[model samples]
Target: MIPGMFDYFAPSTLEEATRLLEQHGPDAKLLAGGHSLIPLMKLRLAAPRVLVDLNGVAGLAGIEERDGHLRIGAMTRHAQLEASELISDRYPLIADAAAVIADPLVRNRGTIGGSLAHADPAGDLASVMTALRAELVVVGPRRERTIPIDDFLVGLFTTALEPNEVLSEVRVPSPNGGSGGAYVKLERKVGDFATVAIAVQLTVRDGTCDEAGIALTSVGPTNLRARQAEDSLRGGSLDEQSLRAAADLAAQEAQPAADLRGSEEYKRDMVRVLTLRALRRALERATR
Candidate 1:
């Protein structure tokens, strides 16, 4: 299906792009990788009057570590993340997600900023970012600001991005020697969206859990934070019993509806299994 007719603009700078977005208002859509928006447009789910292309904008793509944070340019490709030594050595959780998001074709062209901005509940990157408690930097015509990933994601297919704003970067605290993370997903097949997925990040210090983050995907209106599960692990020993309890809490927290992937009961149960697996992997990485 062909997308509806729309005017296209290739802005050389972010400032110019934002100005175009502001001028076009809600009818303007920014083109990043176009994986999300183009499909919607083809299905007629989205019909914007103007398309503002960001490909020409410089300085919107890179990966760097500075000021105690790992900064990923919004336009950074998933393949880049998957292949980065820095990400693989320090933040393997991100690499895990990037390596499995859709397939090679999608990863080759898809952008981190585009994925998060799309805010699809099933998007692998959203849950990963949530588990990392990453910060999102957005720029608009008037100002630039940072929003926590939790707040940036509002609901299904929704985000906190204003019409005139562009997501500029994602910032995550650099992992210490004791910190580790993992992403565990259950899909029907290769490149399929997750039937149930879990992302876990853990910081272990002196045989105790110093920090923990647990988030779920494809089981709620948004990427669901397993707060109770995280709280259960924090400041506690990662014993079999504690891990089981946290897994149970995460399953309980999921709000899955019956779908083609599986029944609600089935998915909830899978959440328990996956969460336990992910936690175990994360703890091993943290301690080893």
Candidate 2:
């Protein structure tokens, strides 16, 4: 299907891009890697009057550590994250999510900002970032602001970003000593969207869980931060009993609907099983 007609503008600066969006208002859209938008446009589900291409925008494509967090530029490609030594060494959860986001073609062309902004419930990074409690930075005309990942994702296909704003970066807290995380996904095949996916990060000190983050994907309107599950693990030993209790809470927290993937009950059970597996894996990594 051919996309509807639209004017295209390649802005070399983010300010200019935002200015174009401000001028064009709701009729304009920002073009990142175009993996998600282009398909919608082709199907005539979206037809913007103008496209502000962000590829030419400078200073929006890098991964680096600053202060106490890892700053990931909005335009950074999934393949870049998967291949990054910094992510591999310290943020293995990010590496795991990056590696499973579709095939190489999609990974090479898709941008992290685009994925998060699209806000698909099944998006891998959504669950991973939620578990990390990442922050999102957005730039608008003459201003910038940061939003927590939890607040940034408002609903399915919706975000806190204004139409005239550009998501500029993602900031994840640097893992401390004794901290580790894991991403566990269940899919029918390679490159398939997850039926049920779980992301877990744990910080253990002296054999006791000091902190924990548990998040789920493809189970609700948005990536769910399993707060109940996280709370269950804090200050507890990372033993089979505690892990089982937390897993049960996570399963209860999931809101999977019956679909071709499986019955709702089946997905909820998978959540319990995966949560247990991920917690153990995170604990092992944290203790090592």
Per-prediction count of colliding residue pairs? 0, 0
Model 1, residue 188: displacement in angstroms?
0.5
- The TM-score measured for candidate 1 stands at 0.99
For residues 141-176, write the lDDT of model 2, one tens digit per residue. Answer: 979999999999999899999999999999999987
Cα lDDT tens digits, model 1, 1-288, are: 999999999999999999999999999999999998999999999999999999899999999999999999999999999999999999989998998899999999999999999998999999999999999999999999999999999999999999999999999989877988999999999999999999999999999999999999999999999999999999999899999999999999999989999999999999999999999999889988
Lowest summed lDDT over 10 consecutive residues: which window, candidate 2?
279-288
Off by over 4 Å in 1: none
lDDT for every model? Answer: 0.95, 0.95
The TM-scores, one per candidate, come to 0.99, 0.99
Candidate 2: count of backbone clashes, pairs at least 3 residues apart or interchain: 0
Model 2 misplaced regions, further than 4 Å: none
